[model samples]
Target: MTKDLLGRHRAVLPDWLALYYDEPLEITHGEGRHVWDADGNRYLDFFGGILTTMTAHALPEVTKAVSEQAGRIIHSSTLYLNRPMVELAERIAQLSGIPDARVFFTTSGTEANDTALLLATTYRRSNTILAMRNSYHGRSFSAVGITGNRGWSPTSLSPLQTLYVHGGVRTRGPYASLSDDEFIAACVEDLTDLLGHTRPPAALIAEPVQGVGGFTAPPDGLYAAFREVLHERGILWIADEVQTGWGRTGDHFWGWQAHGRSGPPDLLTFAKGIGNGMSIGGVVARAEIMNCLDANSISTFGGTQITMAAGLANLTYLLEHDLQGNARRVGGLLIERLRAVAAQVPAVREVRGRGLMIGIEVVRPGTDEADPQAASAVLEAAREGGLLIGKGGGHNTSALRIAPPLSLTVAEAEEGAAILERALRSIS
Candidate 1:
């Protein structure tokens, strides 16, 4: 953990890696809810490696599994059957509660979404997809095509068909005045309008709780209604649980459960938290939908031995310790604290989200909308105070995203909140 080591590492990062507005930090090591920079400065991990690292960074169980599996076999092509991969897929299907579920593993969340889109659209042989505004599927061609935000555009290729609808979440301004009834009505109306006079879509992609686009939670019953609409249209519903799954939401093991249904989505994509820090992603498909997929469509790096082992270890840790329950309790506490903070702080507009996927929207004078600069300042101040957070919303910025690892403790949550309060105080 020295400047020399960072210099060597930085040299390896190619210029082709787009500078996404900000520079990357030189982090060296991490354990549980804390990380160390190259200069050996400890920082609280409120961002959880940009919403990954489900069991906390450097968890012994995940590391041991990866190490042991790597020693045995790092990878084998999809041409061969690997025990760890098969077991992991079985576990995902069982936990997902999807009947006759099938899985397609990949290396990242984007890939999982991409696979979901391919399987879903191909199954129905329908090109049209209905997506919500402020939705983020991923950066890949298919994913970006359905993404609602314009900032991520510069589309490499156009989707065969796509339509955008405004869901329960709003990206334009604050929600202090919106009522529950109004929220549901807005979503329903938009969905109706999108479906009206349009060809029945192949699939409807949505996040049970929007993450990267903004920490916007959908209204109650919205999912139920949305699902009904898709069902009527003969379209599949794909839940992008990449940021919301693996017990991060607390109420259930997966994000789609928040919608309160015996059966959730026709297809569900998962990544980020499954393998702790390892590169792994997957999709759980309904039996009927999966049955339509061709057998030859397999991924090369999907479900590699190391990734599968890590996923298994991570899942074991989460279930054995009931980390989802911790997320519900701790995340509820954090949201309440944030609401209190928002009341006192003028720049703080609204606090929203479920479990650990939380956001603190910064308000400006005479404006209920997002203030990206203020959010950035708060992120910097928090980092200076030994906490790390992320910034995201419609305009490539706005609210501070406070998704931490499930291992984050109550004491750490309190300390991080205090630091965030101080950061807001420093902003004005």
Candidate 2:
């Protein structure tokens, strides 16, 4: 049945849509932190469907909200004044640190980021934009224009003149040899030099922790320093918090807070994990920036009633349960466990990230060369051991991404770590 379904899926779906594993598994359903495959094999879920499952699978609260809202109304597009949408927006606005914030809903992270770029370019009156290297915003044409990762980006042509910046990845760049403070200073100097050479950019969009870039991140407060320089030039700062928002990082509610010295960014785009599997994405900006567009614009299904209900319920559960704190407590233990396991394996290059969004960078046994095959082997080994994880990196795609639900339990973390240890040992 699974093989037949895979065949049909390939026949219907685009070729570019990639599937994981040599024999791709079909997940049937899930509960808590575990999911069962089509063959009735249960596995602990670590990737959480690319971190879209913010809380947990089949969370009762979100399911109940969606069901209740569906009974009332499925969707009353933006043409109608949606009560649930307004309520969710109100809650998100207050939660968002931006003062006088206005929220604009979209259907996905790609749309949310496209909206950010539209607003930034319109408000700043410039087509030139700045983005970090090894960064990925989304798949839309406008979003792709700013993406710096060649693997994710399909084309070179773009509407915006994008300038790639340094500091998103700290370990393999020109400043990799420098100390943290010096690295940051060098990045700032590079940015300053770039600014002098190009037209004033509309905004500098970045992911606090580069999600697709192998969960890599510069030192904490790196953005704060950049913010000081950009502020001086009247450039807007856009934090692409699609993968790092909503307390997934443990220590910070928003990823930008790691560099909070300059206060909130001028714009913040978020998606994935907010709706707990429901399609919900949006941008939060100061009223001045959000309201700059002259023509009327509305997302027909952006804030549909059903999705908003899910968002509200998911948000409530996340806060009421303090899952962020859970992520911190459990994630810290998991990282340490994985690091200890990695230390014994020369193929395991690095263990990086915080909270639930940890990354394991695998390399060749004796050299610094990225070993994608090793990463793939570990992924397969872990899956065989009844664990599910994800893979990503800058260009090599050799980093193992482990982002379990924020509501993950300490016991679950340990169980997953033990399975991962055996998998890594298999490679070494």
TM-score of each: 0.93, 0.99
lDDT value, residue 127 of candidate 1: 86
* Residue pairs in candidate 1 whose N, alpha carbon or C atoms collide under 3 angstroms: 347-363
Question: For residue 416, what is the lDDT in candidate 1?
Answer: 91
> What TM value does model 1 have?
0.93
lDDT against true structure, model 1:
0.82
Off by over 4 Å in 2: 395-397
Number of clashing pairs per prediction, in order: 1, 0
Q: Residue-wise lDDT of candidate 1 within 240-330, one digit each (tens)?
A: 9999998888777777776755367899999998888899998899877876867666678999999999999999999999899999999
